[model samples]
Target: MDICHEAPVKCLAYSPDGKWLATGSEDCTIILWDSEGQLVQEWVAHAGEVWSIAFSPDSRHLASVGFRREHAVWNVMPGQGAPKAMILEGHTGLVVSCAWSPDGTLIAAGSGDKTVLLWDARTFQLLHRLNLFTLEQHAHAVTHITFSSDGIRILSASSDGTVKIWDAFSGALILSLEGHTCGVNKACFSPCGKYIASASSDQTVWLWSIDDGSCVETLFEHRADVRHVAFSPDGMTLSSGACDGTVAIRHIRDIILVQDTDM
Candidate 1:
């Protein structure tokens, strides 16, 4: 077994190349380890628990967020050398999630304030703030966010039981997918951009068509609230981590169609 962390590991991710393992904790630290699970380095980035983390597709940069109100980045070193990593700032509320655009040109983060902030990958400057409407749309905290394969749209899930698609460049709302009876905790587009999967507190995962936002299937596999979901790089497998602490893998072939003519 691998000794992954010294505290409760909140979120974890593998580098695009599958060479590095990045783990975040509530102890205000982010640890980087090799594929073998041996710690290479750790950095303190926030005042409270580090809630989420994401690796740039290149595997050279890391973006981390925490509850105590801060966000940071690190230059991941492969072996024994030290790196002079840089920390970025600018969220007043606790940062809930972070992700890198496909080409790694932009970093997008969601927070408790019900907004998503976009940042320049190189300069680390705030590029835009995506504010979700309340009276007309989402009225609760934005729990998570993801970028589509082409990086032209942003997929945001919220505590309002809905996921909204936004134009990445203009921040204009495009589509909203709603079907889960409870709040959606996380949502991500399939690697091929053909499908979208969302994890919810309703104890189910919903798969929707990317083009029409139509419900494709409802995966009621997990016995408890689903906490997270990820599409394997090949887009053929789906993995979900639940509040029950079980990571369940669902193959794309198993997502049943709601209708015989469903695309």
Candidate 2:
């Protein structure tokens, strides 16, 4: 099935239930596609390019951020006609990324101002601003934000060439994972929560051990900036996408097995 957007798609996401795929575009609109590739719904979601979109854990809602400097949460469940959005405004700069917690209780937004804003999903309240502009914090725009599987930790990728993990509840900086020579575009924890995979503009994907905070493996298969990285639901496979127009899938079960054996 083929679908078209008026402008380039800036971000895309799949519902947790496997029912819908959402695409946000530079045209300032969002389109929801059913599993069959039929358009489920379409609406303008932001005043400018929509940088990111993420579905709630239950697939009942979607949180989006963009060049508009604010994040909007939309009720995307079936039968909700052009649902009203709860706008979260606190960022002093354009919002670049947003993610929903696995439990659906929180939303984290990262911005050009180099801070991650944590919001309560239920009340749509701004709970914490995760950066204080200290020397150790992100020196550049935050490129991505994600919550760990248990929702106890949050990760933020920055153009400063680092990924930082934070305590989700108290907004405390836990660990800083650094090594990328260029900006990190995205990062996410493995399903088992033992590792983190980060993609970078250096054209590499790095797998890091969370407990020891060390680079366990580095893959240099991409010829251009690596834009995204994710682990399979079962955590046996790793996938990465790059600006070179390719998706790379690697079997990571062996890597985990090797680590377990060494331990």
Candidate 3:
């Protein structure tokens, strides 16, 4: 199943309902596909490369951001020529990553401006501007942001080699997980909200305790910069992708066994 686009595909997301797939490309366009891989709709989404895309929890809308300083949310309901999208303006730097809150009320985005902005998903209004530098104060760009499964916390990765946890409602910095030797590229929360997994340019994936902000284990299988990390919906497995063009999936049980033996 090879779905081709005119330019490099930078990011993609699946609708929460599992009915649609949206792909963002360097061609400045977004194409929606059905489960059968049929193109449902295509539209120019941004002026530059589309860096990231995320679907609302209800699967009614898709949010995207990119090299363009702004982000957009599209009503991607089926049966449309060009979906109606609203542009969100405010970020001064390229928007790099985005995620919808578990409850679907908010969308959080990280940018090269070194800040994270929370938006009202319904009204497309800015709710909070979290300046990482002004808060916990980081020296580099915020690369990624995601909400905890319980929707109570926000996890962010930065080019400064640290992952920061924030109180989702207060927009207050909670804890800084500092262990990566280089920039942290991505971070994700376990499905049960008990742990955080982070991928780093240091070529490793780190599992950290959400309870105490302690590094649980550093998995060093990736031969190059690790770009992404994700936990299975069941929270029993972890997967990572790297610049070395490889993806590794590890069972959480195995990780726990290794940790116990090392202790």
Candidate 4:
């Protein structure tokens, strides 16, 4: 479990097929390991800290974002030595997060410049620049973003104490879920795409309903800022990590029962 990197590992991702694991580090390198934990390949991926990594749905491509305001797409195939396919450059600030659409048609990146940029994955062309600078949008850096299971919607977390849902194709704002008292650090869509879970500097994770943008539950217990949140493959269990060096796992059924009891 201890795959050491030269510097702090900022992000980790597994290929959709579960054959390869990729880790990005503050040393500006990306390392690939096979399922057996054998090092497959290593490459200098960026000039600054690699902030995020994600694999295409088909497991053929890997996308990475860095603090250097650029993101790169790499071909991930056996015997292919981490060849860079394209570099996406549009953000004026650090590119903090990246995710590929479910069908592998689009890639979305969040940046410190208060915008989310969408790209055509096939052609590596800029498709849309979603601005979060207005009164209706996030007022600070976008820290994390995820696409819905159907790829029609995007959920973004920001330093502005809010999570916003957007129409992925049209770049139109959908809904903003605000309840956290501090900046949101990470957000993820449930496997069923019916809910969004967000971690915040407020030391809590808020579970929001996608239909009504309502905060259904606020999970607390972490003694420090929550850094990440994810749902199990079955969407029944939720896991969270925090700066307190603790991880918590809760079952969705238990959360529902708690909600019902409160009601």
Q: Highest lDDT, which number?
A: 2
Model 3 CA deviation exceeding 4 Å by range:
1-45, 75-84, 108-120, 123-133, 137-142, 150-152, 166-176, 212-223, 237-263
- Which ranges in model 1 have alpha carbons more than 4 Å from their true place? 1-14, 18-47, 81-85, 112-135, 167-174, 253-262
Model 2, C-alpha of 235: deviation from truth (Å): 2.7
Candidate 4 similarity to native, TM-score? 0.66
Q: Residue 102 of candidate 1: its Cα lDDT?
A: 78
Q: State the displacement of the C-alpha of residue 27, model 4, in Å, after optimal TM-score superposition.
A: 3.9
lDDT for each candidate structure: 0.75, 0.80, 0.78, 0.79
Off by over 4 Å in 4: 1-9, 12-14, 18-23, 31-44, 78-85, 90-93, 108-120, 123-142, 145-147, 166-179, 211-224, 232-263
Compose the digit string of candidate 1's lDDT tens values, residues 1-263.
23434555566666777666666665677777675557778777678877788889899988887786677877787565665556666677867888888789988887777777888999989899888544235788677777777879878898999999988777788999988889998898876677888989998989888778899878877877877777656666666656554555566765533332455
Q: What is model 1's C-alpha RMSD?
A: 4.5
What TM-scores do the predictions have? 0.72, 0.69, 0.67, 0.66
lDDT for each residue of candidate 4 in 193-251, tens digit (9 for 90 to 100): 77788988999989988878888888886777877677755666676656544556677
The positional error of residue 114 in candidate 3, measured at the CA in angstroms, is 6.1
Clashes of each: 1, 0, 0, 0
Q: In candidate 2, what residue range of length 10 has the lowest lDDT sum?
A: 1-10
Model 1 alpha-carbon miss at residue 1, Å: 13
lDDT of 3 by residue, 1-263 (tens): 34656765556555767677677777888888886768899988888878888888888889998775868888987775568878888788878888887788888888877888898888889899987644356779777777676768878789999999988788888999998999998888876677889988898989998778889988987777877676655666676656544446577877656654765
Best by TM-score: 1
